[model samples]
Target: MDPIKKIAYNCRQATYLIEKQQISSITLKEKIELKIHLMGCSICKLFQQQSMLINKMASKHFADQHKHISLDTQFKEDLQQKINDRLHKN
Candidate 1:
């Protein structure tokens, strides 16, 4: 197989292993791999970090929604927009 295909396969396998919980999220291997990947591949590293964080937060149950944006900062703006019909005003 081509080197590109092999690299992609390896990345896919790594992601699968992580997603399938085959690797200890807190293990030394996980930490090292994450750091190394982050150094080499920013996009995949970011994705891995976010995916792992979500999985950990969900406790492997795969909840319907992963997170809620607290209405603390944007709430006021959203509330004002709603009241003023800002989104459709234009």
Candidate 2:
């Protein structure tokens, strides 16, 4: 494939990997290609930054919300039992 097309493909794959938190899953050559593409593509770079920021903010928000919430063990066990009973009945 041509260099431009290859870079574009790499950028797309990089974004997918980033969103899935699987950057480490990509091969070394893919990482190198993605880095090179990011260097030349301002739009992709901005996208990467924005995606990371969104993920960070979401994680922090969820963490804070979870801290203030508690679940009763009995309630959980009862709910699971009820679900199992309904499934078996059907």
Candidate 3:
């Protein structure tokens, strides 16, 4: 199979790379592969665009929200204990 075709046909890899690229830089090979795949795949392109928009909106909202939010130590400890209890039960 052609290497480009292999990359282009794997929507799963294309989508994973789309998300990975947002968090950090993908390698040169990965960037090229993802570019090739996105050019041919409309669905993956839409997903990439939507992912960018969502990340942008979340960053904007969270930046403001973080300034106003705080949790006391006791509440944090109780929440952690409940999470631990749930994990142990599972």
Looking at model 3, how many pairs of residues clash?
Answer: 0
Best by TM-score: 3
Model 3 lDDT per residue over 11-83, tens place: 9999999999999999999999999998899999999999999999998988887796789999999999999
TM-score of every model versus the real structure? 0.34, 0.55, 0.64
For each candidate in the order shown, give its overall lDDT on alpha carbons.
0.62, 0.76, 0.93
Model 3: lDDT equals 0.93
> Compared to the true structure, candidate 3 yields what TM-score?
0.64
On lDDT, the leading prediction is 3
RMSD, each candidate, Å? Answer: 13.1, 6.9, 9.6
Ranking by lDDT: 3, 2, 1
Instruction: Note the clash tally of each candidate.
Output: 0, 0, 0
- Model 3's C-alpha root-mean-square deviation from the true structure amounts to 9.6
Return the lDDT, model 1, position 2: 75
Model 1 misplaced regions, further than 4 Å: 2-5, 8-10, 20-39, 60-90
Q: How do the residues 1-90 of candidate 1 rate in per-residue lDDT, one tens digit apiece?
A: 975445444666556555655354456765555445445666676777899787687775555464653567588888987988966877
Q: Which stretches of candidate 2 lie over 4 Å from their true place?
A: 8-10, 20-23, 66-90
